[model samples]
Target: MSTLAAMIAADYGTIGDILRERARETPERLAVVMETGEAVTYAQFDALADRVAAALQRDGIQPGEAVAVCALSSIPYAALFLGALRAGVAVAPIAPSSTPGAIAGMVADCGARLFFLDAGVAEAQKPAPVPARQIALDGSAVGEAFDAWLAPEGATPAPVEIGPKHPFNIIYSSGTTGTPKGIVQSHGMRWKHIFVGDTIGYAHAPVSLLSTPLYSNTTLVCFFPTLAGGGTVVLMKKFDVVRYLELAQTHRVTHTMLVPVQYRRLMEHPDFDRYDLSSTRMKFCTSAPFSAELKGEVLRRWRGGLVEYFGMTEGGGTCILMAHEHPDKLHTVGRPAPGHDIRLIDEDGREVGPGVVGEIVGRSASMMNGYHGRADKTAEATWTSPEGLSFIRTGDVGRFDEDGFLTLMDRKKDMIISGGFNIYPSDLEAVLATHPAVVEAAVVGVPSDAWGETPVAFVAARGQADPEAIRAFVNDKVGKTQRLAEVRFVDALPRSHIGKVLKRELRETWQKSPTT
Candidate 1:
């Protein structure tokens, strides 16, 4: 395997360099299209980005500063992102779906100096600590719009020299908890992961669908790889079933990086076959795996490259199942990508054999520097072994097959041990989702009087899923202990922006409910 240095031998030093190089190479290539239906070519994007950088500098945001963007997917957003990178500023993408308190916490955590707000969205979203100024992305103040402010009079800000180690972003994790700590990504890992993504599992994929929100680390898997390869990005503001299929066909979308629920929705769409998906080549499912049954359903309808990966934002875009390599078909997340060292170790930190389910650990050029501003958590996640490998504990129970395929069995903290049997929520959820009427399923261990921890099933049904039928369905499929103690037939499951069923919320909700 080539070293990361060899991989980046001809690399551009910083994000600014990549922007300039793209502009020089393909000045007229369409770079981004906004929600308002405006398109900007490479030349236009770079120029306006320079203007935003200068405008920001004029407002006292200098190199290496932090900026919070509380806007929806728009043309102005693309410009703002580029400008932040060009000006050597870090970006925090605050989603509209987040509450005002959450937005404030994130912006405050990143310590943004100035926020470029889209009032319609930002006013609704209301990012915290509200930056020094709130410049609008759209709407004119006395006929002077954001673009007019960027009259291109000021020269592009001088490039700030950055090593691979300089921080690129302080991305917060998806789940809203007590406080979301930032994930610090280094400049080195940012580009390294992009390159690894292009060659490891996905090639220079053209026209990837951004149906998933732009606020995720998974978004990095889609957005940067295409941008680096000079391919087109088919952006979607939100998930609309028909629009997804239509755009995929219209743009001849070659790739899609989405969560499992999104894939399930695509397959369940009434108008699934209304457009041709022959051009769709790769599908990436990794923020929680879709059931193999769901993958089969998806492939049956849309058929293309199907790959699953297992990794967190903290782990970087490091682990993957390469296209066309199907060994442990449904169980494994596949082998380690090049330059990544991975292992499964027991509780005492000793290496476990291939079949022994233990905690998965890894190290790579792509691992985050550390979780931002939390040393104790950082120490818990990342540590160095005697052999000098920078090991990161995945907190996922996994094992490698003799055939070298890697499988995730369960999360260490998420496992339910009852009556001497261990059960993974994913395993139970998979069994539950296969039932005819189950639209969504979340399995969490609730307190049990007899067993230390016991599994309870919470389901969101589609057409006719009542508690009895669904409980019988799961009981018939999984082991006796895996059967739900009680089932909650809720109208809908709590979901994050990218649509992973928020089991944490469901667990809390179920705890308070007398029915469960």
Candidate 2:
């Protein structure tokens, strides 16, 4: 085995082992810091995790069992996650924004014997049923306090053999309920992400400021790498543009991960240029459609390497666009990362030639094992090639340019079939975004009498933009078959927790409206 591989196998095979190593190497170094000024040193954090793991083991929670946590970002919350992994248990971090029913469903779906929540979450989800054994991160009447629930200090749980294929965590789909699919990421996948940080300069004692929720994979992508590299991670419970800039400047944060919406807000902030963001070394964006314009603006203004990652949480394949390096290729997500095999296939499962739009299917080292407890659904997501190699089917439709960069067209479900002509909403939305008066735009297909479905646009205007005029401008730019059926002005487009435009919600709202 290679020298690095041998070291990893000996001392840092799992998340728990790595944390233990860091604690022993740099006990005084700060491991995590929250916006509220709370911080944990490596030694203290590791001991706290030991206590938590011991407590879980005392409660008869066996290895490979799942522990669910639904709370705002906090120091204790981070400890709980590490503690579960330390004991060979899987941590399931559910979205705090989910409805009570959805929260309950996710906790149950993970088969968690212990549920952890903050006072606010417990109060908000009082109506939802939880596990018999519950603990509160923030002292609340709903459950036992975190300090009280932990085992004695310095007490450690018995360690179990951790293999590469062992499940590390189960991340439930956002805004999902009624048999929510849990994406099971294995230890090997996470290890790959952690060690690969060396190549990206994450091992240079980088300090990452994570503004997104802990439940999001987007946040974890930076969070785990920062800690694994023996650096500090600053957490933010919620994102506020002013506060974010203040913290980034104060901490001299070198790295961060943000979705596209957050980037837009930061750029549009009136005092965005006032802050000294020179300390930032790398800034990553993902989880939504990042426009070429936005990428250009950040590359011009932001003092860092701006990268855009295009992939799914299921982890089939990832394409990285280094905006600072590939200034001309801003319109496309970069070529597949090393070891990622990507291909385009038509609806009938036939391979499409270069430049032909088709659904993207990919296979990679980081791919998930499968959906938890749903073999049928898992099988549906996998597409077997003529060579019998399996690949994960990304529901996105895109075409590869001659340069090998992938330009996303639209989601398969979002494609509008108007009079038998396929229209990509992104094409119309891109034109709408070019208008000076339009801040942002989203297009969705609506049921029509004459056509099978027609495209309708919802736009957030920058100034006094007439809906009719905006519609006319966009219609003139697009093809006749892809012209907008109607245009509606809104203060903002509806978005999910991760900044993805909620087109499904828009369709439902439009269908129920009198104008439609």
Q: Which candidate leads in lDDT? A: 2
In candidate 2, the residue pairs with backbone N, CA or C atoms under 3 Å apart (3 or more residues apart, or in different chains) clash, namely none
What is the C-alpha local distance difference test score of each model? Answer: 0.72, 0.88
Please write out the lDDT profile of model 2 over residues 223-299, one tens digit for every residue.
98888888999999999999999999999999999999999999999999999999999999999999999999988
Could you tell me every candidate's TM-score relative to the true structure?
0.90, 0.97
TM-score between candidate 2 and the true structure: 0.97
Candidate 1 achieves a global lDDT of: 0.72
lDDT of 1 by residue, 133-210 (tens): 566777533123566656365457765666777777777876444467788887787877676556533445367778
- Per-model clash counts, in order, read 2, 0
Q: Distance from true position, residue 383, model 2, in Å?
A: 0.4
Clashing pairs in 1: 34-75, 104-128
Q: State how far residue 503 of model 1 sits from its true place (Å).
A: 0.9
